[model samples]
Target: MARYAEVVRWPLVEALAAYEHRLREHARRQYELDFIAWCILAQSGATKRKRPPALPTILKEE
Candidate 1:
């Protein structure tokens, strides 16, 4: 369990740092929001499917 704790702790710290940076940059709040969602998903052991697209994907269907 020690290994797991170390791994989890570092990422949590990093996420907080990133969140602070985003707040300074005055970017949209969505990124910080998404980070919180991602943490919840990780804790729930919900397997994520394929990675998200590198760029935003917009659908223009009629």
Candidate 2:
């Protein structure tokens, strides 16, 4: 849990610092996992794999 502080903090701090130091157009997001999404991911860490992948590889049968 403590290890994930960077994952949650980096993007927000990065964005805020970018805006503070640079223009909005120049400030690109470094990560997709913002604070809210990170919270969700942390809460639901164990995602259930009830169904097979939507695009499973096809195989030739003998």
User: Estimated TM-score per prediction?
Assistant: 0.34, 0.22
For candidate 1, the per-residue lDDT at 27 reads 38
Q: What clash pairs does model 2 have?
A: none
Candidate 1 local lDDT, residue 19: 63
Off by over 4 Å in 2: 1-33, 46-62
Q: Report the number of clashing residue pairs per model.
A: 0, 0
**Cα misplacement distance, residue 27 of candidate 1 (Å):** 3.6
Which residue pairs clash within candidate 1?
A: none
RMSD after Cα superposition, model 1? 16.1
Best by lDDT: 1
Local lDDT at 42 for model 1:
71
Worst 10 residues of 1 by lDDT: 53-62
